[model samples]
Target: MRDILVFLIVFGSIPYILRNPVVGALMWVWISVMSPHTQGWGFATTFPFAYIIAVCTLASLVFTRQPRNLPTAAPVLALLAFTVWMNVTFPFSLYPEYAFPQYTRVMKIMLMTFVVAMVIKSKEDVRRLVWVLVISLGFYGVKGGIFTLRSGGGQRVWGPGATFIGDNNALALALIMVIPLMYYLQQTSTNKWVRRGLTASILLSALAALGSYSRGGLLAIVAMCGFMWLKSRKKLMVGSVLAAVGPALLLFMPQEWASRMDTIDNYQADASAMGRINAWYMAWNLARDRIFGGGFEIYEPATFAAYAPVPNDVHAAHSIYFQVLGEHGFGGLALYLLVGITTWRTAAWIVKNAPKAPGMQWAVEMATMMQTSLMGFAVGGSFLSLTYFDVPYYLMCALVATRVLVQANLPPPAPTMTRPG
Candidate 1:
């Protein structure tokens, strides 16, 4: 019965998992553990669905055939272990209550990273995962579209747990990240039905993003689309036309959606931009003073003290790069870059080498989406602290792991047989 329940949950959650790894992972995190912000209760309060899904996945993995290990797992594991060690040893001062949440977040990411490496062994698995993600995201987009039409499209409407749901910008960013992957899937899928489905999912997700009134999200999507277009001009033209027409016909949205175009302008004035420059200035001065860094998670009070005059509100540098530099110092920053660069380079290499291989294609798609997502995050991180979100970080690690796995599985280049004269 326990095994059956686990199977049911893993299969049931497949739809959501397909749509967005971030959402799926977050759901798992919420369920396996509890969060205080939502109801002051643990898993029972916020993540019932995720809890069930996670338990089932663990059970399924245990019961399934023994999984093969990848070669790159060692380095990735070492880095993660080092990161956790540094966090603990550095004695970064965060609220005691946050300790559990932080730990749980890390664990969830690790779990997802493992899943990405273990489960995505073949092209079929990749296709299944992509379809699931598309369908799930499409469902959300449809839901969001309905809500926008019903509410006359004002502020972004979140379902039950608004606490877990990110703001318009964040949601937009999340959806934007998926767009490239969807496009890649569409291009590679042989089955007409699969291609059609991916197309529909992309359109729906884009509409959902636009409806969210997240200027940042809109910008990110446009940027991703542009990048894809640059890669394939013919596809880009068709996509651009479809994108323009789809939102107009499907839902009644607000004109203010366009206002987000001016979002960059705020940075110019440096006043109403909400203290971004001040934060950057403060971060620089803090870095200068503490050449080694304040410690992981130590950005709040320790660094804030230097900023003076106003009360020191405990906040992160709003950028992952800066956050790493400020908290973990130069060494930590180097590791972060090493992990990122290694994963990225490996993914790119696989894509370039195995253009025709389905697994390779999927890897390319994942790599492209991740790279774009990272870019979006970097831009958005200039104003928001998105690193706390498990999606981007976990996906990056998972892709690296996947690259390692894929490379390890490839048969050694057949030894050129010497001509037997």
Candidate 2:
């Protein structure tokens, strides 16, 4: 039944997507990020819904009269450059067979990201996309939060299987990133009941993150909350609340969660932590030796044996920074970092400029919260290989689109007349 419903909804939307490719892009973001099909059983679980949506979207894009244009923002340009660089290094991949599949996956994500940038034309479109994200990922946030509460944080909250966020740690980081977006919606929404419900969702999602018991997630929450407070207009009030709530939530978690987090301070004693360090070292060594890096799937035993100090201590390049470094080499890592740095700057620009346009305060809030989300990703993803995650890229797309709208709506500067120069 669940599978049938998912199938019906997805297939039902194809016509609308063909009419307006933006719908396809939004649906693409939904299926790709949330992996709703993964929630169902039977045929829907194996169905290639995303591929169908992508084809329909591209067909619509080619046929539709709608004006298509990518944003000229620095972030978008950097993303394009990074995409090209990925292709450049593909032929040089150490294990092209393993790398090809992952490379294709990343390319698809990049393509959809650009589609989002081109199609999202208005503030309403941005809001709609935000709603899609919230509803899709927030399902996990709300459900996971409840599970955490009911289990007394004794069990971990996990994402749907076979998805990027399927792991507990990945799900926790994903939730942490989404929480701020929830806050953004709550702030912009006029409905009191909706705001109230969102507040509850926020609390539950935080609990869910705790339930995951990911030390990196815990650090990310701290970093994100701090950055969020810094961005708030009422910093003192926000700071006060955070100061009060932070410890209370931590105390509520079970002893096991505490012990796991405690390992952060004594990482040398933790085997998992040590393994990650070894992987990081391997990535660095590979990048130093090879110009284009080892290409995708470079975290194999052979690569680690060649580059890792402890040849026996092989592990995935758990860090996003290292993941790019090992797979793409120094140039790829530079482009990857450039994408993030430029996105951050672009969001900051929107925050600064959005206020100049009256009634654009929502844009300000959006950019600010997006920055908070980026902060969470940057911190949490440091310990996780989510370098190719669609969520962050989509966030960048929204930010880039938001900047475009904000700039367009911004009142033209009053004409200046100079007497004598």
Task: Choose the strongest candidate by TM-score.
Answer: 2
State the lDDT of candidate 1 residue by residue for 64-163, as single tens digits. 5645343355436545754664465355433334444654655565665565555455445444555554444455565665666667766574422443
- Candidate 2: residue 94 Cα off by (Å): 1.0
Relative to the unseen true structure, what is the C-alpha lDDT of residue 300 in candidate 1, on a scale of 0 to 100? 55
What TM-score does prediction 2 earn? Answer: 0.98
Candidate 2, pairs of clashing residues: none
Q: Which stretches of candidate 1 lie over 4 Å from their true place?
A: 1-65, 68-82, 85-90, 94-100, 149-152, 157-165, 188-197, 233-255, 268-272, 287-303, 308-316, 356-374, 397-421
Report, for every candidate in turn, its global Cα lDDT versus the true structure: 0.55, 0.91
Off by over 4 Å in 2: none
Please provide, for model 2 over 51-157, each residue's C-alpha lDDT reduced to its tens digit, 9 standing for 90 to 100. 99999999999898987888888888999999999999899999999999998999999998999888888888899889888887789999998998899999988
